[model samples]
Target chain A: MYKVKVYVTLKESVIDPAGAAATKEFKNSDYPEVEQVRVGKYIELTIGDTSKNVEEAVHDMCKNLLVNTEVEDYRFEIEEAAAK
Target chain B: MYKVKVYVTLKESVIDPAGAAATKEFKNSDYPEVEQVRVGKYIELTIGDTSKNVEEAVHDMCKNLLVNTEVEDYRFEIEEAAAK
Candidate 1:
């Protein structure tokens, strides 16, 4: 089995309103050191099958379902895991 | 500056409707191997000033603003970076 962790994040060129708001909020609060903030999605998957190429399958999943390519960029890491 | 990556995830006992739906969709689609899916928040922050304790500040941020402690678990990592 494979345990995969995927991160889908806004592109640097895309303005992140949520991040901006969070930054403002941080500044207003005690965290003035927080200069920039970017929020993204972290997806974890437990793939039961190991016969297929895990990386290829995960890449396809990201492209097809998890990520919006226009405004977001994504990356993933895979690790072998004991079946659960 | 410091580059901080925070991962906020639902507790194992909590139900994840979105993740369950995604898993169902994957089973119906090409990724039948996907047995389980868990979705979480990936937050990135660039802390400009390094004078204060970065980890302590981040912990406070997560506790006060970034995470809902009741149903979620949060962890963060910090790396020193060239001023940006």
Candidate 2:
């Protein structure tokens, strides 16, 4: 089995209103030093097979559905799991 | 200034109901091979100062407000940005 990790985040130039709101809330709660906040999403998947075909399929899923490539940028890494 | 990256995730033993729902939805959209999805949160903060006091304040904010230490696990890294 292999573990896949994906990180999805807004394009660097895009404004993140939600992130700003969270930052505002945090600052108001006595932590006034927080300068800025940018929020993103993380996803993990465990694939049962380690075949090349499976890896290609997973990549296709990430490209077409798992991430909105137009508005978001995503990066993924696949790693071998320790023997269980 | 320094950049702080924080990753917050549900404990390994906890059930991720939202992640499961997202996986189900993705599978229903013709991507049947997607086995599972575990969702987490990522936060990035840009602190205006790199002083030890500033770093300590950022750590405290992360511990008390940025992440729910009870149900979530978080890790952070600080990096110096390329001079612009």
Candidate 3:
């Protein structure tokens, strides 16, 4: 089995209002050094078998399902899982 | 400046509905090898200065604000930023 982790982050040109709000809240509380904050999505998946080309399948998923290319960028890492 | 990335994931015991839904959808569509799925939060923060102990502060933020210890596990990576 292969364990895959996909990270989807906003593009450099995009503005993250939610992250801005969180930063504002944090700065108001106790963390003033936090200059900028951006929130992204992390996805973890377990591939049941090696039947398919795992990397290619994961890349396809990221490009089509997991990411909004116009505003977000995504990358993934796949590793062999220890048997369970 | 320091660039910090915090990845928050669901604990082993916790059930992830969103991830399950996605996995089911994927399996139904074209990816049958997807066995399990989990969704998590990825936070990117740019710390403005070096006055603070970056590691300590990041850990504190993760413990107190970013992660809910009950159902989520979190980890962070911090690296010095190149002057831009």
Candidate 4:
């Protein structure tokens, strides 16, 4: 089994209103030191068993549905998942 | 400056409907090998100069606003950010 960690964020060229809002909120609060904030989706998947290469499988997943490639950028990492 | 990477995940006991829906979609699609999918929020923050410890500052941010302690769990990593 493999544990896949995916991070999906809006492309730099795109403006992130949600991220901007969060940053403003943080700055207004006690954390004025926070200069910038970006928000995105984090996905974790547990692959039971597979003959295909883990990297390839994850890449396919990301490209297909995990990310909106046109406006979002995604990256993933695979780790040996512990047995249940 | 510091770059903080945060991962917010729903507690294991919490049911993730979105994740379930995505998993079903993947199974119906070309990637049946995807057994289970879980989804959550990913946040990246850039912290400017501060006299306080980075860890403490980040922990405060997480506790105060980042992670919803009621149903979510969060963890963060800090790295020296490159100068812009």
Please give each candidate's TM-score.
Answer: 0.97, 0.83, 0.94, 0.95
Better of 2 and 4 by DockQ: 4
Model 1 residue runs over 4 Å out of place are: none
lDDT of 1 by residue, B23-66 (tens): 99998998888999999999999999757888898999999999
- Whichever of 3 and 4 has more TM-score, that candidate is 4
Local accuracy of candidate 2 as per-residue lDDT tens digits, B1-84: 667888888988888998889788866865554567899987887766544575677678778777777778888888866534
Error of 2 at A2 (Å): 0.9
Model 3 Cα lDDT, one tens digit per residue, B1-84? 889999999998999999989888888878878888899999999888857788999988888888998999999999899756
* Better-scoring candidate (DockQ), 1 or 3: 1
- Model 3, runs deviating above 4 Å: none
Query: If both were scored by TM-score, which would come out higher, candidate 2 or candidate 4?
Result: 4
Best model per DockQ: 4
Docking quality of model 2: it rates as: medium
User: What level of docking quality does candidate 4 show?
Assistant: high
Best by lDDT: 1
lDDT of 2 by residue, A1-84 (tens): 667888888888888998989778866876555677899988887765544575676677778877777778888888877634
iRMSD, model 2, in Å? 2.0
